[model samples]
Target: MNKLIKKKIKMKKLFSLLWLLCVCLTMYAQATKLTVDCQNPGWLSNKITYGDQMTVKDLTVTGYINDTDIKFLCALIRDRALSGGRLNLENTHIVGSISILDDCMSNGWNCLNGDGHLASLYLPKSLKKISSAIGNISVDSLYFSPQKIHAVSSESFYGGDNKKYLKHLFLGENIDSIPKYSFIDCENLTSIHLGKKMHYIGEAAFYASTNLKHLNWNEFTSSLDYIGPKAFLNTQWKPDTILIGDKIENFDVSSFKYKDGCHVFLGKKVQQISNASQWWSSGIQNIFLHSKSIVPPHISIRYDELHYFTAYIPHGSLNAYKSDDHWGKMNLIEDITHVDSIRIFPTNIVLGHLGETASLSAKVYPEDASIKEVEWMSTKNDVCIITSKGTITATGYGECSVIAKSKDGGLQAICRVAVKESRPLTAITLDIHSLQLEKGEQRQLKAILTPENPDDSNVIWSRSNDNIEVSNTGIVKAKNEGKVWVYAKSTDGAIGDSCKVEVITHVKGLHIEPASLTFKKLGDSFKLRAVLDPANATDTTITWSCATTDVCNVLEDGTVTAVGEGLAVILAYSNDGHYPSTCIVKVDTSTDINIQTIDYPKETQIYNIEGKQLTKLQKGVNIVRIRKGQVRKVIIR
Candidate 1:
């Protein structure tokens, strides 16, 4: 019985051991199960070295991660092989670039022989930055579309002929600088877009990138310093153009290289050019030096199609300008146009002050080989001032002609002038002995001007504070309140005229007749009628209005029409001939006519009519007058 019991215990122990082994094997297999999620595990605690050979295809990783996880994840990819045998990172992202650096350098990454498949990468928005430790990768195109990225490190992408396979590289907005040698040997790169917020670019950042055709540098940077010598040498291209910031002061040699033709634009602030001659000898055809005060060393101008010269040389350096040997050999030079002449005239100048303002003129010319900009300068204060186009304005008292000379060499001209002073008529007046009138009376303003200059043309009349307007026909109207000052302005620059009158605002009554009327979009001629209060309608004018002048238009005489829509505000003003009274008239677009009797009689008649009319008709029978779309009546006794 004791032996049998011991046997049973041993059997149970063996069974338990077998069960444990099965569980261990199951757990190992579960962990090793490969899928798209684990393809780019970004935050593993351990990293696989470049020695690891792995490959995978079509991975999707979306989330926050740390550096260690990314390193190991990359190693795992290098150790595996994908279907049809090509390593692929379809879509992936990491908080750093170290893992990618190790994976790219694995087993002498060679895309040329197709041994390792490291070609394209897509970074999502979750990545915060790309690490500087990124060393080598055979990937041809790298796309980084994250919300932010810190930098692209030096030597991050290095390879040989396969380097040309990297045709496109996208940097995100958060990248502030491009580290030196980041894309040092990317010979196949055709376009590189630096982020807008980037302020610093390290030396040789794109050295030996021969295939790079277009580079769009940051626009707002103020201190962008590093661009190395021959940095973009031996690139295959057409006669492409290059543009640098207007504020940059220092530049490197051959920062921009082209195949057929090239040009360099020195910043406006660059005051001098010391070295950098080899770049000029390459494909560069033009050198635009935009400096207010600087001259670069002699340039070798060999290209035949280059003829445009633009430079801002200093004003006094005419003798220092000499064309280069090659530039002097050109057979044809474009003709230079002469600058405009100066002119001066008197505005409100007292006739006795002709010496202060006399007509003057001068001509300017293009500068010599130096290409200095020409400007007009005045040496004497209040004596005169000259504009670039040579328009002179007199300040004080004197006669002087404007002077002009080339900024570099050649070209000059001047205009002749004469000055004279004679006493001119300053004021004109009407000597009224006295206005003959009883109490409570008014009169229109009338006057003549004494010749101060006898040439001024704008003359206007006023009463107390209001204007008593007069016409070119000498017809005057008392348009406002109080005493009147009939002043005349001269448009031809002559003496003005003035007169005075006392106004009585408290008139018994005043009215401008024809309170309402209609017209076409053009106009209708009608007599301006005025009626005084207390049955004394006399010495009055009917002024018209459309209220808003910019809109509909109306004449000074009472004639109006519909210009736009809604309602047109017409005003009828009685000037007393002293002070005027105003009345508002509402004009409706609808047509109106009146058929009434002048006397009690009878007959039937019709006639087309125009102009002012007065008639009376019998109550039953009458002759109706009809004009353009309107009807009226005439009565017969």
Candidate 2:
């Protein structure tokens, strides 16, 4: 019984050992799923293997990774180690050729064979070039953003047995050229996006891409310079619509071979067609040319190729095309025309007076139409006469119709012209009612007439005195110092208006009387006078102001009054802006001073500071003055 227990214990120890071994193996398998970061240069030489429970599941390459590292990765793919893996090299600066060998059997691994699963590549703008043999790898999807790639090499996508697996191709901007056989034999390529910067499509670039349904050649702008022969041969992309942009200037022969039943819109800048033997041959229906495009001399579509095709030319250029050497041979060329109409300008006209002339114009619809000239005639010549060139002249006082008829069709438009009689002279008035002038001064006056009339309302200007001379057009000249009356009278009737003019010599300087004055207390007033140098200066208007209004104040007529016990300056400025004068007024607060009544008459009235009449004067100050006369100051202490 003890021997039997020892056997059972040994068996239990064996079972525990096996359990620990299994757990270690599981941990080893889990740890073998590695991620090789190509950003670390150390990993570039590291051989990543698969199929022995050691798998490199993911590889990340940052922009710092160079082409050598990419080449190493491609070599690993060729050696069948990184098969069925994911390569994320987005925004990496990997450039140069990407070569993948077609002889997968040389690797001695089934993963590199025809049924081998290649790594999915995510490429972005940093990559510049893709090697021609990259298509040898059996990749299901290729995310390519070749914005920095200027040209794609020939046979760049020349996949051997794996050509049928490429599903999507994304071409980025800045790729201008696609060499011959770039995407040759990519039979399973279903979708492709071409960038706008592409200008040249080489021979057989997309040949035998059977699953591709449509190719948007319309994105090719004027930068599209050339298209090689058989560029799209045998492709399933028989697009129903093909729009060529305004920048494309040339198209080679057989460029769009096997493309049929499409409506092609040609751009304005397409000036040359090298050969048109096989373009739009099968089932083209319509071809619309830009309004400014001129067909080249070498471009000619055979009758059999375009039997049902119609060429739509510019509105006014159809005849030119039909008369040309090559374009004239096009049997279905037609002009784009619109419905015709007519319009007359200045819909309403008013003649100022009899015998006055005015001009009228007409515009025809479809400005470039064959018949753009119009015939102008007056409906009533007795009222107003109109020339054939649309010039109208008033004959008598009435209304008439100026009719414009299109020469091509019977469409006509009319403008109504009214000829009214001139208004009779009612009254005449000058722009200014009164005028004051200095010697050698001149002024231009305008005359306003009541019941304004453009004709028959002439005014005659005259002067009553010779001191100032009036011109025929109401210009007044001040010759000597005196007053005169300038009159503007209507010629028809003697009705008129006159302006009183005062002309005097110019003032050289200003003189202030009593240049200095003294005031004993507040409420003291003084009358100041400003005299022109010549004494007869017409500009006697003066403006007065006190330097300090808190101490003294002045009126518009040079009347100064002391308000407080302080000295102040009273200034007088002439209306002509020159010859300024000032008066110095001194005030004393030492004594109880009384206002002087000498400057005022006995009939002068007495009032408070607020200009209210008072039966008795206040104890401080009073304003005593006559109505419309000088003011007097008084202090009642």
Candidate 3:
């Protein structure tokens, strides 16, 4: 009798469980759905009563909504609860920055008195600057993107940790920008739908959002401008494809994070890609670069015997990319545009003077050909040299062929160049016969030659006395109050012209002669002249000093004597202002300056006194260097 009674009690409990499940299913089937225009004064107040909150499972608020309209809905929610349902405030056109929770708890009503958690809630499509109360409201998902939102407020998706329940978010239409740190450390965020209207993503906008993954960027970010550094750093993003717009010309490191095997489309205007050697882009097995550059844009990537990935570039650029220093490491394929052929303007080019230069121009078969970048090279560089832009430099008295090659199709065009020895210089004329300058002022004197096209355009500048200073380039500086004769003498012969320079002011500066010197043996000595401006100066005297006394020494009379091997700077101080004029002297351990008519190796390099490297020797002083360890100074008079 006891066993039978226990069995009856167990059966009764099982029947009660079945009844509770049926009631839940029946309530959902009978839940009320409401749609109303928020522009109506009593849109919510007329349709929803205080006790009807739980009954309304779906609520669609359309048209413009203000602060008062939101209060009406809160008044009803403060009395009831809800299940996994939706409440969509389509586009709040009237105003932006409205808060839902703030209206419900207004007038000191406790937040605890409001409804239970909501499953999904879309704030507004036209509302910008997500407020704290709206962002903090109890909702499982927060959906908001604006067609009119152009500014970023700190109280956005990154307001506070109170949005732990917020999960999936979606943005659509014209959103301007995502400011820096907008969604930092939002570990609960799962997926985001980026709209088509965003201009840029600020630095570290979504940084450290570890759990945030699966971003649904639109087919094309047409208005995208820039993506800041580390914008998506530490985010769990593993999208299948990434589409970059044309407006962005640069990408900062750590700006985006994606897994391996993702397809990337770079707009045609992109000129550079940094960190392509790093894991960020190395994992990407395929990339489509639409740059219209004939010469491939530089790519930073890991180079090995095997290619890391495949690169699809504009047509006709296959030959260019295949030989590139960076892009060649990857498998390159052509896409669309190509160049057919190239032709040189002139079949032969002739340069008369040694220093003369000429440009070789060309035109593609099709006038509208895109790949027009051509490179120029000379077959015999010893005769004449050519710059990358097709400018030919006549180095010696000989003949050579310059070839212009198109980077895209690798088509060639050749032009022969002939450099002849210049005719003898018969005479030299000055631009001005006489000129007067201030104490510290300087002037450039021009030298006109008999034969305008001379192989050696070289002139040596010299002054008659200590009244002024002149340079090798024919520049004159007034030193004394008296007149001075400035002469431009040709290196070929004694043919030259002279100009009279007169000072017309008080002494203001000092001038130095023999600016530099090379000492061959120990105890070599030379006197340096330091002339003060305006010869009428009360004190024209100067004192001499040597910075490196161990290497060389200077006498009070301005005499520089080389005692050791090295460089020494000799300075002469002016009596009035203590300003110093300097001369640099270098001593060689063992040097011979009398070598005449000797052949030189092809590896020999030459430089001017000004430290400018020369492809061929020029007039005045030349430094012939066999290597960095060996050097010889040669002077041509």
- For lDDT, the strongest prediction is 3
Task: Give me the overall lDDT of model 2.
Answer: 0.67
Q: Which residue pairs clash within candidate 2?
A: 222-247, 222-248, 261-283
TM-score result, candidate 2: 0.43
The C-alpha lDDT values of all candidates are: 0.46, 0.67, 0.69
Provide the lDDT at 243 for model 1: 50
**Tens digit of per-residue lDDT, candidate 1, span 1-637:** 9999999999999999999999877554442222243344443322322222232344434443435554444544454542223222324443335434322222223111233334555544444433322233345556654554566643333333445556777666777677666667776788766667666666556766777776664353444544444455555533443454555455554544544434444554543233333453464444443333334334443344334333434444323443534333333223233343322223222223422533333323332233334445555435566677655555655444445555535344433322334434576565452332222443544445564444443455433354344455444555544455555545543545555544444335555556554443333344545566634333444455556543245567654444543344455554544334443433333323344422323342343243322343333334364444344443232
For every candidate, C-alpha RMSD to the true structure in Å: 24.7, 18.3, 36.9
- What 10-residue stretch in candidate 2 is worst by lDDT? 103-112
- Lowest summed lDDT window (length 10), candidate 1: 104-113
Candidate 3: segments with Cα more than 4 A from true spot: 1-31, 36-47, 62-79, 91-116, 125-129, 133-135, 145-147, 151-154, 276-292, 300-309, 322-324, 329-637
By the TM-score metric, which is better: model 1 or model 3? 3
Shift of residue 607 alpha carbon in model 3, Å: 99
Candidate 2's error at 171, in angstroms? 1.4
* Residue 542's lDDT in candidate 1: 48
Q: What is the TM-score of each candidate against the true structure?
A: 0.37, 0.43, 0.41
Weakest 10 consecutive residues of candidate 3 by summed lDDT: 102-111
User: Model 2: per-residue lDDT, tens digit, 1-637?
Assistant: 9999999999999999999999888656642234444555434555344332244545655534444554556665555445777666565543322352221111221112223455476654554444433545667566655555577632344334555767776666777788887777777787776777788877778776767765656665446766666677666776655566666666553566434345566666666655434543544454433334544334654544433445666645676777766566555455544429988888999886899988899988876565577888898988898888889999988898999988777689999999987676777778898998887799998998788764556788888878988888889999888889998887754688989999866667887898998888689788898888777765678889887888889998788888887778888888764779988888876544444544445577889888898755566668767767877576666
